[model samples]
Target: MSHSTNLSHHSRRIDLDAPLHRKAGPMTHAMQPVESAGEAQTSQACPTPRYLTNSEAAAFLRLSPRTLEKQRVIGGGPRFHKFGRRVMYAVTDLEAWAGERSFETTFDPEYIDRHPGVQRDDQ
Candidate 1:
């Protein structure tokens, strides 16, 4: 129920009774980088849904976290799940919702009226 981490500029172990991706109080840990490129490739080959905190999901979607919170309240953000009191988003759901909002032009109905800041970048 604990994982290896280096917090407070010192090596320590942290309990993970909840999901590892969730922030522990004010302390949030980033995915630890591997020691070698081989490890990086290995990790990428075994893809996992990266669970994101609301703030992290907001950064990933180029929105303010407050916007996500509002979306949660009023409905219609990317699908998210609650781990008890914690709210977590899956990368897959975020990508799917972003894909759903993709539009070709700024004048597209959904683009202008509904999802103002989102557009399909065909790149």
Candidate 2:
């Protein structure tokens, strides 16, 4: 199949920024082209391989980057790595962290019954 047909008809770029509630698939929009501000060039230089910065990762989670950083400091946020002075967020980590809570909604009732909560006589 031709590459053009594989792309969304409404948008040439894949719509990666859409939330997790959307269909699960490879990003559907074409990558947005970015240019370095300091360099002068006639052709569009390729975008650097995108890694989620603190702000970007926070945005991905719909929280402020500072809050995400706080979570990281508290050991409550998604896993991250340091590349020199830059902190890089893993896409898999972000996805896993973002989706992990949803699993709690579909629990096995028998399991919960077996593992009952704090015992109380006020039944």
Candidate 3:
């Protein structure tokens, strides 16, 4: 991981070699890096973790945006922060929320409800 200065007089450290391409696609012609709107939206940082938007968080949780929104409104979902009009979910918070929903039985949706002192996997 190499950090270099941007093309200016200033020597501020910035990583430019990080791949922003989302995924590699099948080549129909000469192989070229296919850049899309999604790729453009992604950050190119290596060591730093970025926040997830509503869509990104929903995708990360494998749920629909509407479902995540509903959970947020009802106050039983991953913790989130609001920056002006934008809603953001931290990666750690999302992971913790998902971990809390885990159970030994897949059929029991009310397992957490029935069991009282069951701690999360973190314990």
**Could you say which candidate leads in lDDT?**
1
Sort the candidates on lDDT, descending order.
1, 3, 2
lDDT by residue (tens digit), candidate 3, 47-102: 35558899878877778999889988897889999999999998879889998878
Show model 1 residue runs off by greater than 4 Å. Answer: 1-42, 107-123
Give the Cα RMSD of candidate 1.
13.6
Instruction: Please give the range of 10 consecutive residues that has the lowest summed lDDT in model 2.
Output: 26-35
Candidate 2: lDDT over CA atoms? 0.64
lDDT tens digits, residues 4-105, model 1? Answer: 775778666766643554544433434332234575687689787779899988877879999999999999989999999999999889989999988888
Q: State how far residue 25 of model 2 sits from its true place (Å).
A: 22
What TM-score, over all chains together, does every model reach? Answer: 0.54, 0.45, 0.52
The parts of candidate 2 lying over 4 Å away from their true place are 1-50, 103-123
Q: Candidate 2, residue 4: CA error in Å?
A: 43
User: How well is each residue in 1-123 modelled by candidate 2, as lDDT tens digits?
Assistant: 565554445665546545534545433433222333443253336534446889778767778989888887887688898999999997678888877545343255543544456223224
Candidate 3 deviant stretches above 4 angstroms: 1-49, 106-123
Flag clash pairs in model 1.
Answer: none
| Candidate-wise lDDT, in order | 0.78, 0.64, 0.72
